[model samples]
Target: MEIKLCSLIALLGFLTIANAQTVFDITKCGATPNSDITAILTKTWTDACASPTGATIVIPAGTYKCGVVEFKGPCKGPITFQVDGTLQAPTSPDGDSWITFCSFENLAVTGTGTFDGMGSAIYGKQKSKAVVTSNGVQILDTKIGTGDDCISVGDGMEQLTVERVTCGPGHGISIGSLGQYAGEMPVKGIFVRNCTLVNTQNGVRIKSWPDQEANDVSDIHFEDIVLDNVDNPIIVDQMYCPSNLCKSKGASKVTISNVSFKNIRGTCKLPEAITMTCSSAHPCTNVEMCDIDIKCTTGPAKAVCTNVKPVITGIMNPPGC
Candidate 1:
């Protein structure tokens, strides 16, 4: 495969600060067995990504334990948390968010490390709310876990992108419709590319409430993604009636348009191959699907479109070419 990928950028202009930025090096800070990391990470000794731009947070190779990591501002602009080790959070059953970056932009997490949200004790009737928070979160060659969404974008989220991310054994990536409240504003300008999934619920999905609805979702594109043992591969199921109380309510107005899928291959072990349940009134249109390959053991490859435009140029399997 080509090493071509786009960078996820968030907006926040910065001017003052040392070297026009700052660096938080956890290694040189001696935050180990002898050092008090919690204190160093506080305003007394240190602070979490505050007033940072053109700055980098370096977590050199080590296993560090933390709680409720919240990034406070200027999280935009070439910020790299070169995670060279594991940053783990406590396990909670009550369902809590591991790391949250709100009202921030231009963030990237890179390294051969992990962020373990020891949340094995948690359970949810659904795996869709955790990622409803921010924008421009890039999981490049990094491992994140436990919490509801490895990464979730909620309200006022635009230009959000997830690339080269490996998520599984946790809640998959969910692009929400923002319901009727904060939960119902609609995520736009989303681009998910070159990612892998293990045992996720729905790989590459666009979810909406059974009741709430958004006006329109423009400039959304998902491409070059892979799923090993995911359930719903290519799901655009806007007809979802959350809790099954009203899947037929037809209040789903989240129009997903200008979507292009290319080089997407996966194995759907549960639901149908491509479950495209859109509104007949305002069916999703201008969708260019090229090179969609799937390997389903039993079921068939069935695609339903109302007023949508799907250009199938490549295939493999019974759904094969």
Candidate 2:
């Protein structure tokens, strides 16, 4: 894995920051074009993290091949990782994640760059979970695609907002297959709005494992979304045992409540456009569907619901369940 740092002016350009802010450019820290910058980049982050005032680490415009890197911080001040280049991950999986930023008080990953995971090589063999375990996070104006879920909201996520994003060639945005492990925290206040999905397996789904530990998922909402040729446009699957792994484990103990799907219009590939198979043990409550107009390509669209009674209002093409 090597990074090609082509320009020197781009490095100097980032150094010219505000008076109180310090800049750490990888090129200045012994990084060269088409060379392994793992060590140099780590050193740069260390220096920036030690700064008393705020600091920014800049990766200039070029193609860089990087291995597994974890940027851990308990810095003295705020930190920003600014990238204006493409970052290509290793061909083979090195760790759970290609890049990780953890334990930061105030951190920003702002970039016009791309993080290419090189997932095509090992698509079906090994799938990675792009998990989100944070609060007060906002993912806006971005495009994401992968073999697995484009964005998987994992356990302990709250006040998360994903808006104006385009997702496709993937499993769309999801809120768990939660309750797999014991003592998992609740997920609340998730909002996904104004997104577009094309050729995805599922769109805007919330899933959980059956016969698992008890957990609460509430205040989840999906609004103003558009789907094209998607398999399942809107779904809430409590019996989400992929590959029939858990045969008949009583029912999911996860309690889902106050979920709304509003103003979502699109075309679905399957006739069952909306499927809400909630747990019989703890059925979903306060589920609402409004202004939904999804059509099936082959036949008439329909919705299948079990253990969930949604409050339907306005223009339901599939005739809300």
Candidate 3:
């Protein structure tokens, strides 16, 4: 009876090993701890995603110098890229984004890691630290900094949640600058909560193109966020023409609606604490704010509103409209 029991136990252990999920450590696939591992990472990702059951690609703890790390897939099953180390972007990445997740489904990027975009080296040239275009995506407990937006969400993303993340020394979290390209898709159903922004240009911004209408972004929520000396604490910029480049002299093309900001308190680096400039042709609707408070260092914080109105309640500093 003892021998039979031992055999059964060994069989169960072997089965567990066989059925367990796979974890692909990048180190095993020619990724050095302190080198530019872009090519190695690409190969590792391809191998891991080829598994019959989805796998976890682990970026272990070290500073990995890389350029243009993009993971693209309609992967076989749910996939996870667990970053337990720092991903360092080159001074000149030769691309707009440092890291990109394109066309993925059910992807989760979670871990206590840092993504350094080397912003100061290439200020105003780099676009963003990370750009994500995926469905059922969750980005949690990560730190990001870049010259442009810390995290930019692309179109056609659904069921997205960004929580407990910190951003700084860059443009804050943004959605849109949408409606700029042909076949542009709408982004909806986003929830951003428990995030902190420090020393950033803009915080919690939603922007669209100047003219050429036909994209819609709706059903957004930003709650329980802390901002430390951010330039624009809360902004909805419809006339999002940089360097005065919009020649049409028309309102923005994108339509924004059903947005809410709740329990946000912080300091504004600029005098304009809150700015909501929507389009006259396609104004923003159903905007709501609660427990919003931010003060400027130079003067009394003020809000700049045009072409839209918001329902305000409880402790608005610059005062929303």
- Best TM-score among the predictions, by candidate number: 3
Predicted structure 2: lDDT? 0.81
Q: If the candidates were sorted by their TM-score against the true structure, best first, what order would they fall in?
A: 3, 2, 1
Worst 10 residues of 1 by lDDT: 1-10
Instruction: Name the candidate that leads on lDDT.
Output: 2
Residue runs of model 1 more than 4 Å from their true location after superposition: 1-21, 27-30, 33-39, 42-53, 75-77, 92-95, 124-135, 144-149, 180-186, 245-248, 316-321
Q: How far is candidate 2 from the true structure (C-alpha RMSD, Å)?
A: 4.0
Give lDDT tens digits, candidate 1, residues 1-321.
Answer: 111110011112112456676555654444553232443343311233544346666666777776655555454355655677777655552334545555556666687877655555444422444444456756576454444555555656777777888877655666664454533555677888888877776777665554455556667788888878777777676666655655357546567688777788878676465666666556777777788887665566555454465666666332411
Put the candidates in lDDT order, highest first.
2, 3, 1
Per-model TM against the reference = 0.78, 0.85, 0.88
Question: CA shift at 93, candidate 3, in angstroms?
Answer: 3.0
- The alpha-carbon lDDT assigned to residue 9 of candidate 3 equals 37
User: Distance (Å) between predicted and true CA of 97, model 3?
Assistant: 3.3
Worst 10 residues of 3 by lDDT: 8-17
Name the 10 consecutive residues with the lowest summed lDDT in model 2.
Answer: 1-10
